[model samples]
Target: MKNLFLFLTLLVLSVGVNAQQNQIQQDSTSREKLDEVLVKAVRVDADSPITHSNVDKEELAKRNLGQDMPILLNYLPSVVTTSDAGAGIGYTGIRVRGTDATRVNVTINGIPYNDPESQGTFWVNLGDFASSTESLQLQRGVGTSTNGSGAFGASLNLLTDAFSKEAFAEISNSFGSFNTRKHTVKISTGLLNDHFEISGRFSKIDSDGYVDRAFTDLKSYFLQGIYKDGNTLIKALTFGNKEYTYQSWFGLTAEQLQQDRRQNPYTYDNETDNYWQDHYQLHWNQRLDNNWSTNIGLNYTKGKGYFEQFKEDESAAGFANLIEDDSDVIVRRWLDNDFYVINMNTTYKKNAVEIISGLSYSVYTGDHYGEVIWGSDLAPNTNIRDRYYEGDATKNDFSVFSKATFKLSEAITGFVDIQGRFVSYKTNGINSDLVSFITDAEFSFFNPKVGLTYQANQNNSFYTSYARANREPNRDDFKNGVTEHEILNDIELGWRHNTNKVALSTNLYYMFYQNQLVLTGGLDDVGSPLRATSGKSYRLGIEADASIQFCNSFSTSTNVAVSSNKNKEFKASIDGALVNLGDTNISFSPDLIIGNALNFFPAENLQLSLLSKYVGEQYMGNVDSEFSKLDSYFVNDLNVNYEIKPKKLFKSIMLSALVNNIFNKEYVSNGYYYTYDDTWSDANAVTTIEGAGYYPQATTNFLVGATLRF
Candidate 1:
């Protein structure tokens, strides 16, 4: 498969090279329009009734030193980010509107990026992806119908760097706290004879994280070839990463945190996670006529990895016929998977009406296995590479959607969307617990959405929308005995006001759910969160954001969100009995989140900005116990950027720096809570004992970088 992909890539490059000899003249306007078509099916226009935010390359570059994408987006409205290593380089996660990453749908150039079985986006697998992105759009709430998993909380879509018209080369290097460093090199062939272009990037990042024994090493690359003529565009791209990170998922307990905040519990020398993933994509866009256009996308992804661990006093039966009843052992858990996807979409725009229709299909296969490499005692029949537990899974997903927009009148616009999705999942074999685990499930869902926009005047616009979404349980959810599908009904109303120096947006949302899968604050063996079905829940909130230019040298951007999240008539199993919790707060849902940025443009070539974030206290479990509460935190950062244009030997020289947690406040951003019934200690009456663990954030850190472009 790898050879086939390589051959196809070479073929596309050859075709582009051969066509470049003809000296074809291209229109920049047409090229821009064609580039937009690649992601139009999964995105919304500014005039649409959806609530969204757009981030471009220029905005991302200021803090693009070495952090992951989630950390760069931390200042966005209603966003919260966490890093397992106490820094922003490895094993990072993001939550929006109090919803976890698994509920966020992600796409790259209209191809699904979330894992099929887990429905989670692993940013570590695509290290330094922000360097290759041209622009990204984040839609809050169930705003639109998209491919792969349903959008329960938000949808994020990214477009890779566009082909350049002139040849260029760039080198970037950065060094920061925690012995962290990054090196990057990029080159572009530009438009050869105005018909072809090629570009590529390579990056390496290393960090000795703030936490003890938490280190990361990453290497990644991106390559693409493009051919354009008239109204037709063809692009072939490939991107991948290899990562090795020390284990840090096991967080610190309260008592241990008090003793030492940076201590690591695991002392084994070889405890680490190693993974590699690669993606291949081909996109073709054509304009059929003046009012018709179409786009086709194909994607193939291959992933394989393993994490090693040392177990103490494992059971003989668990190790598959071990000679001793209790012995120490070292094991490795592996996951190998293959995914293929195809997407097709067509658009028609004429007069006051525009319509878009698309279809997406995907197939995924994975093998899950564990092997016992070394044991304290072994039987004569035991081989060196004997498998202890093994399993395989297959999943198929298909969807069809159609959306339309109509200018009902001079000031009012109407939108409608409909989608049908079908999925089938099957798995078989023994689980790691030495028990049989088999599953075969199928689901068919129909979702619909409608909205209206009213442009009252040149500076004021009002919009309202309602949407429905349904999602199936992921692999870990199934393992935790949760089998029911979840459903959400969402409604949003907003108003936008724009002028020369001020831009403001305010919105109200009410989301009602049936059989919602809420996090239980408990992690599985591999650190994936466990979830359970809540009978009924709702989230009601008001969000406001603004960008104001006070004068020629100063400006400000700010956003705030206040919400009420609850699980109505909640129930839980207490000491050997069921208890009604009665309208408890949902886990991990904070009431208030605020973000602000104050920018100063002292000169045309220099800029300075101060960013701040505040997150309110929230419960880690649905029961709202004092033990599950995470304290509120307020943090600040400072950023500076300076540019110099040279007349000779270079196009530009850029210098950037960032100081995080400037106040040096020690805070914990994420944690887990769990309860277990103790029957053995108290035979007469069972007692439910509660405990919690926390992940601490770095106190103060800095990163500085310089880029030379020619």
Candidate 2:
């Protein structure tokens, strides 16, 4: 604690010394005036018309740094985060409104990025990938039809760095709470007299995770080579790698967790894991006519890695694990993926009937390898091979969509959007154990959506939309033992407001699920998890977000979400009172989640800022019972910078530093009891005998860094 205090004191002193010196000539607060800074972050893709929100490179840097993409996205109105590693920076998750990430579609350059088999995005697997993202867009609801992955919740599209003109270089170092440190380096070389450009970036991040053994050592790089000229552009990109200390999915035993509170809370040990992914992309953009543009994209990803750990028991002879001695269960896996997509669209600005149309096609080929290193269930402790289960898969996605804007009148403008999609999925090459019976299946899906938005005033707009989303069962959802299906229908209504300074947006969504996967309170061999299909489930919620620009050098942003989501939950088996699913609130669903940031610039050469973050109470299961609730927590962050002007023969420079979690606070992001039944005994009724019970958050951390650019 003393060390932490001293670090903080030094940070404050540094900021005070380098802080910006105000310019007295400017009449800012004294005179009433407003300045405008128009944002050019929006992308000009072909024929796609949609309501989109974007964060530019500058905006991304202003938020937190590192691989926790969801943390930076928390300000989006209809978003919430989940974490097992206490601090939101390490191991965390985000849900769009009420739908989990599986329903949240993600794309890069119009190509699918989700794991073809799992459909779940484990961002932790990407390491310091955020450092490479040049710009990103988040489209809420069924706003527009894009390529690949089902967009039930929302869609996020990202574009990496394009080519830059002139030679430049940058270096940034930052440290914050949780012993988190990030080091970055970037260089760009403009060649061929502005006809060609090349750039690359390298980043490394290390942290003693919030959870014991939950540490993360992430390293990655981005390299881009581009060719551009009037009417034609072509580019190629390669990048990705991530490694983390394993916190495993296993939760804490209620007794052990309560007694220790600081330890891993799990029985298993020696589990540090590594994950890596490499992507190669080729893209071409061509302008064929005055109002026509087209883009063709091709990409491939090679993903291979695993999280290894020690197991408690050897034989699965029965549910009783006490019969055997503790053992080591090494779970290994590797995956290779390739994708292709092509899209074309045209636009016409003539008259009130503005027309936009487009067509897109996407395909994916994915393969996986799974093996068990040490398991008594196998013959005489012999290492397991293909017999354990591994396989290959191929899937195709195609879509056609169009939108037309019509100025119905001067007070209100309206637009109509429609889209159709066809999806076919298949997997094979291994028996029921490796490829599994689940892999022998073949399925198809047709998704359609439509929507409209009307402006009531300059600051207010109302919109409504409906969409049908179908998901072929994922690899886990297809287990041979007992697997079912997953499909969803979503309808949304919302309002949006924007002005010169402050902006507010709210959404109310209703979702229906068929053959929804519900937790059977089961565990996989590696402490992952298992779920079975139940009849139905739904999530309804209200979310709001706002941004206020108080003045040129000052701004604030806030976001909050509240909702109830669940399987066709039941209050009583006998009474069978229809559970609202929206009543008790979904497991892991928090009643309130909020984040706020303030930026203050005291002088032309200096800037200072303070940030506050909060997430409300939440539960661990469908019942929303007493044992499943997670307590709320809050934290603070401070940032400061000073510009150094050089004289005569020198260049200019800037120094910056950040201090996070002013004071260490003990907390947990997620936890669950092993059993949910009515057994109330001491010997057999331990709260967390099996399931992962708790994941810890980060403690007090201090880091000071600087940046230099030329």
Candidate 3:
């Protein structure tokens, strides 16, 4: 015990000393124009729609290289970023207002990016791809009805930079905290006879996380060609790519964590996994008439990746004898799986009313393989079921959507949206011991939403919207002795205000989960979620965000959210009686979250900034017990930049430095099911089997970068 204590003390001291030597730079005082994002709303309106918040090019430039797009979103309020690297750099994640990425709708050029089956966007699939993004927006709540699946938490739309009209070239280099570094090169071919332009960007990022064995190597490229004249425009844009990362999904027990303070932190369901992705899109825009316009887009994404994990001690936890043969070889197997998706969209716009509609279709398949992975007779992998041949399982999805906008009065505006989704699933290599679920179970729903926005003057606007979202069981839900069904309804009221110097927005939301897949308080190895069944849940929350320009030299922005979540009245399987899920917070959902950014400018060609982020308490499960609760914590970041132009060659350049997590706070941002040491003996089932989970947060780090434009 004394030796363990001494080791932890030395570890903390080492981190602190290393952090001090690498304190992030804070040295400049100027601001550059932020990037301008383009979305479906832009094609339908004269300016950015009321539902979106723009993170312009300026904001994107402020972030150090190798930082994932999710981490860059931290400047906004009501948002939190979780990292496997222990410092928001390498493999990171973002959640808005208690909703994780799966609930958030992501679109690229008005096309959906979420997997049709899982409805989750894996940003790690395209590390540093942000280097190609010209602009983007995060539209909270049910934003204006546009094309694609649905916008539950927020709609993220990104616009890739179009071809530059002038011929130019530039290079950027940055290095920082956690042994992170990035190098990028960009070039543009000037317009040909004032009709066509082409541009491309190539970038690479590498990082060794603050924690043990967490490493990231991401590389990507962006290419675009455009032809435009007067009112017609045609363009081809492509961006996406490859990443190699060390696995960090194995969560530690409370004792293991406290005992080995410098161990690897976990943030995902799988460990020791690495993957890749590549996508391509083509689009065309035209002005049909003065007040009427149209945009047609098509997308094709090719995704092929798998995550692997190292099982510690390949023995079953429960019913071990049932899963083994008479010889008692004690067989065990690991999981290696792969999948893919493809999609397309189109839209039309008019003066008083607009119609944006499109169709999307996706097909997915995967294979699980390894040694003799054990399974009890009740769900054994005989017939090579769990170990399906490295091939595809046929699962398909189809969706169609349309939305309309109406101006009822000078002070009032309304929107109506409708959507239909259809799904068909089929698989053969499922575990032979489990039900064959080989049925073509078809599920569809008519999702309709109506919203009213009243302008109570330019300083304030009040709005209300309601929507019902239905999700059919995906292939995963039915793969291993499991099935799920449900309709998730969301109701919201919001306010918006803006002026030359200030902007503010806020919303109140309530969500009802009709049939939730309740966790049965049991977890499988490697943490891919497993659940039994539950009846319902209710989540209520309020989120507010604001931006201000204090004179010409300073600007500040703040975002915050507070929420109350509880399981609805339901009968428990144990007692067969109605009971609350307790005051337990939802897993990974923080109750009170806040973020603020301050930009200071004391002179021309220079800028200095500081950002603060706070995340409140949370519970990892429905019971909300002391063991499942995660305490609250805050983090501060500082940045400085200076602009300079060489006497010859490069005309303009900016040099910047940033220090993230200046205070070095320690907290748990995410958690998962864990098993006790004793459970290891059974290799299957044990009497003291219990629930234990864990997730860790970030640490202090620093970075330096340079930006140049010609």
Task: Estimate the TM-score of every prediction.
Answer: 0.95, 0.80, 0.82
Q: Spell out the clash pairs found in candidate 1.
A: none
lDDT per residue as tens, model 2, 1-710: 33334433443443333223222232222221100000011132212234346787756665445537887676566566656665555566777655567667777666667776667677776555676777788876544556666676678877676566677787878776567788888888875676788888888888776556666777878888888776567888888765565664665666657786656745455465656778787777664433334455667777766655555555533212212344435555555566566655443333344444555566777766555655644445344542345567877766655555557677445655455555666777653233344345544454555556677776788876677676666666765344444677777777888889988777787777787654443455554445556567777777677788999888888777676676664442212233334334555556666777777888897878776667677666555556667788786767676777767432446566656566676667656543433346555543432234666655665556666666
lDDT (Cα, tens digit) per residue for candidate 3, span 494-564: 78888998888887888878775544334454444455444677678888888899988999989888888
Top candidate when judged by lDDT against the true structure: 1
Candidate 2, position 519, lDDT: 48
Off by over 4 Å in 2: 1-52, 87-90, 176-179, 242-244, 265-270, 316-367, 370-387, 429-435, 440-444, 457-460, 480-489, 512-523, 526-537, 566-584, 641-654, 673-692
Model 1 global lDDT (CA atoms, 0 to 1): 0.90
Of models 2 and 3, which has the larger lDDT? 3
Runs off by more than 4 Å, candidate 1: 1-32
Question: Cα deviation of 694 in candidate 3 (Å)?
Answer: 3.1
**Could you tell me which 10 consecutive residues in candidate 3 have the lowest summed lDDT?**
28-37
**Please, what are the lDDT tens digits per residue for candidate 1 over residues 553-656?**
99999999999999999999888899999999999889999999999999998999999999999999999899999999999999999999999998999999
